[model samples]
Target chain A: MARLTKIKTRKKGGATEILVLVNHPMETGQRKNKKTKKKIPAHYIQKMVFKIDGKEVADANLGPAVSKNPLVGIRVAGVKKGASVKITWSDNKGESGKAQTTV
Target chain B: MNTIRRRTFLKGTVASGFAAVAATSGLLRPTEVMAAAWPKSAFKSKKLDKSIKNLFGSSKVTASKAIKIKAPIQAENGAVVPLTVSTTMSNVEAIGVFVEKNPSPLATSIDLTGATAFYSARIKMGKTSAIHVIVKSGGKLHVAKKTIKVTVGGCGG
Candidate 1:
């Protein structure tokens, strides 16, 4: 299935707050498929970046320990309303996805 | 089926130590490196203390009531346990989550530049374990943890 990423931005006080959620199995390569009963290979997002107005504000490194459809929240200083915020993530399978929104 | 899957899990666990090193070596090729910025040693360490030091540069974390971890006291499944960590403390720089009994203790470390005192994520747990939430603020490390029982396997069973 194709991964889905969602981004939401809001201006709070003097900073822009962004929240992200991505859909993926986040398989640790350690689980078994119920019917076939074979171990499912590991497939999970490894890195994510958050940008405000094309400028990188923050990022994260994740492992399979993260839950499926992971959620993250971040804030950047000095961003005004209508400022663009973009988020992108790459997984272990070399698959990548992104989403964007405005504050 | 059970024995076969258990063997597979055992093999993955054995190779995971090397997996972390390979992830950092950049020997896996350029494209792979671009996708890998994960702290190799931190996620590979089996010991919680070692992983904490590898990520935070110090294991001397003080217990704090200011940090609160919101998770179910009993999780029905180990695969997708939702957690939210919020702190009343200010000037927070980063937040990290660690499962004390996972094959690798350090799950993920998130860096915050101008973020608030709240962060949330879904975490995988192999079995029952304590979730350690570490908050870095004012150059000091403060922590809180919650133990959750996992009924189903998130990692290999």
Candidate 2:
């Protein structure tokens, strides 16, 4: 909600490239709290679905291993310019975010 | 409280010793589990082999020269390591990244429909270990690996 997911796209002929960056803690649940000294609950993105013009192109299943404020990308073909590229990601805590861009 | 803190401190560090491997991987212990379409068993596995097996549904991966893994030979920081996995293999259905020494070796698995076999992401490294790239093409898993030395452990926090 605070840090929105950022979607970037580039088109070269029929090939399209998409880069998605989301801001999340991506906690591993193994670290200790500075004050309370308790383990921080694991919080991270669980699923990232990429769609091109409303059609699913890539689906990423993630875990806590991803770095904080994750950055992931993919390249595809057959996408035309001016088409919409969208990314929707949901975390383990049932929270989600979305972003879209035009190539 | 002192002993517990010490144990946790040792768990967050990879230079402490290999004896802490079990405790180190335990750092990724899933507290809240997963949502739909997420692979729970694969991400929960401690060992690299088991995680790979649970991810692509088989440990039967063949060494392939087609898959290319672009990552640093040595990572100054374990918290954020850049990794790019690309392959010239045809009919690629999915790609998976694994950190051999991480508590959860399975970093992320991507199912590609219209996308190419090229994928890039940043992942955490628990220690100096092997990073494996598994490309699923034509229903078979093709694999490649690169060992990256981590100066600091990321699982610490």
Candidate 3:
């Protein structure tokens, strides 16, 4: 799955607002492999990091229980109107994707 | 007296055997049995380090409560669950969702631009696990998490 779509950031009060869309399958290990007639091993994204203007701001540890194509909302303080923000995420399979935006 | 003693011994032997059998069978829950039967190599990944670096850069992330994740305490269907993450902080840059128990864990990541802060979306749940929300604000990381129980697993169960 891909990360970050339709990203938008705006000014709200004294801080900047942000919105985003994420694409992911988020498969749990319980599923079966159709071709092999065996169970597919569990594989899901496990970590995510969010940064604004090169500074670490947020991080998360994930598990298999989350749903697919998950969406998230966040607000940060002291961000400028045109500053850049970067988002990165990784899964158990060692797959990673990145998205960046300017507020 | 000999006959009564013989009967009691037989009864004791039978009870012990039954208890042993019950104990052995109790160890086999359907989920545990299924997991054990599956091969471990099927889920192994070789690119874990590269993936992490590519996504989060080299900086370490801290835990905070600037973000909130809203999900069902118990999901009836694991295939689809409605989830929402919202934060009150300003100058937000990005948000991410994670499942703590999934083999791959990192479910989705999103980046935002301009200054707008609110977002909403639906995601799939395979099993019961914790959901995490991470946000970036003013160059610092803020996070929140919630546990969700998934019933009727979505992974083709």
Candidate 4:
């Protein structure tokens, strides 16, 4: 199966910054097809949660105005090396996707 | 008699609502509840002030110097504008980003837990406009803004 999300991390200001890239169209519903001239229905991730070792670190409520293929970075303090990280996201249409990584 | 009637009406409504959930989960209503939790009006608001009010309950905000916004002064492509917000504030509860020109001004809102008051994300700008980042800390909302010039709008074809 193709990965729907990718995570990368780096240390920043004494905290570990995790960058999550989710594969999504993020259609704004206002966009019109160049040739078809039909409005693209809005379909974007509405919520996402980032957890470390089963403990929640950040919870996001996103809107359709976010760019396609959402790239989000969050900083967590005192993150141990080799900590398991996971991101679960759900879209406006109730479809969900998830990805995991280790720091 | 009036109290009895009102109670009956309430009970009937609750029963139907529960039945709908039962049809899907048999008992638990995770999907329905999550779907209902998304702030509908907040994301539908077109104007900046209205969206700010819907998201944070008030447009009245204070500008803070402690907050830093790392975004380009100009975006060649409006579809993907990289933005990052980092702060030294303590007790940061939430962070939100708004685009003044998008069809829906509110772009993202986040709840932080055990975090270091930092967030980076990409947002679509409908056009050249001011983008605001609001940070909730110590029960007060602090804001920082940057104007990004977009050569092409991201909303339409």
> Which tens-of-lDDT digit does each residue in A7-66 have in candidate 1?
977776566668899988787777788999988888788888888788766667798888
In the range A33-75, model 2's lDDT, one tens digit per residue, is 9999998877789899999989988889888999999999899
Q: Write the per-residue lDDT of candidate 1 for residues B1-157, one digit (tens) a residue.
A: 9997677667656655566667556566422332345666776689999988767777899999999899999999988888888788988877889999998888887776555666767788889998999988897999998999999967776
How do all the candidates rank in terms of TM-score, highest first?
2, 4, 1, 3
Tens digits of per-residue lDDT for model 3 on B78-105?
6777777777788776565555555545
Clashes of 3: 46
Between candidates 1 and 2, which one is better according to DockQ?
Answer: 1
Estimate, for each residue in A11-65, the C-alpha lDDT of model 3 and write its tens digit: 7656665554457676676677778879865556555556788876655444454
Candidate 2 versus truth, CA RMSD in Å, comes to: 9.0
True contacts kept of each: 0.72, 0.86, 0.35, 0.84
Candidate 2 deviant stretches above 4 angstroms: A11-14, B1-36
Real A-B contacts recovered, model 4: 0.84
Stretches of candidate 4 exceeding 4 Å from the true structure:
A1-3, B1-36
DockQ of each: 0.43, 0.42, 0.15, 0.49
TM-score of each: 0.78, 0.84, 0.47, 0.84
Candidate 3 reaches a DockQ of: 0.15
List each model's interface RMSD. Answer: 4.5, 5.6, 13.4, 5.9
Q: Which sections of candidate 3 miss by over 4 Å?
A: A1-6, A10-15, B1-77, B84-156
Q: Per-residue CA lDDT of candidate 2, range B101-150, in tens?
A: 89889998898888988898999999999999999899898999999999
Regions of model 1 farther than 4 Å from truth: A10-17, A33-38, A75-79, B1-36
